[model samples]
Target: MTRTLEWQVRVGLSEEDGTTRAEAVLDTGSEKLIGHGVARCNPQDVDVPVIGDELAASRAMKDVAAQLMKAADHELETVGAGPASGPVAPPYAWSDTTA
Candidate 1:
């Protein structure tokens, strides 16, 4: 069987106190989740707005991903399945899980 669907995500970024903050909203048709992230430049680091935006956005998405995983795990439990094990972490999210 094959199925297709769309999920909507909106991310916003703002700067304050030498830090950038990112807020993300995910709409999964049946539910909504919020994710947040922040980026701060060190005193010695070159202050770059784009870098800060990228870092904050990446972190916020990570937050949203955690929420998505938790929801899916809950659904699996609803059907008597066990919580997902092993790793699905960032920077290596595509690793094959088979042994």
Candidate 2:
């Protein structure tokens, strides 16, 4: 099949006291999902706004990636595929090179 698909993502962040909260949205052509994450500045650590944003944003993006995986798996079951064999692992899921 020849098809073109695109999705839009937006992230927002807020800071209060020593806490930073981030929210991310994924807007697929037919679906919308939201994810949230929070970061805190250590009491004895220097406050860096950019650092907080980066940490919180990373967590939020991870949260949304999980949602996308879950949605795709749910749809795959209806594509004439046999029942899954136990739990399925995502392509190239986290791996460690430890013996």
Lowest-sum lDDT 10-residue window in model 1: 83-92
Worst 10 residues of 2 by lDDT: 80-89
Q: Give the TM-score of candidate 2.
A: 0.82
**Mind giving the per-residue lDDT tens digits that candidate 2 earns over 1-99?**
999888999999999998999999999977888999899999999999899999998899989999888777776876746346576755776675666
User: For model 1, what is the C-alpha lDDT against the true structure?
Assistant: 0.88
What are the clashing pairs of model 2? none
lDDT of 1 by residue, 20-48 (tens): 99999999898899999999999799888
Q: What is the lDDT of residue 75 in candidate 1?
A: 85
Each prediction's whole-model lDDT (CA): 0.88, 0.88
The true-versus-predicted C-alpha distance at residue 85 of model 2, in Å, is 5.1
Candidate 2: stretches off by over 4 Å? 80-85, 93-99
Off by over 4 Å in 1: 84-99
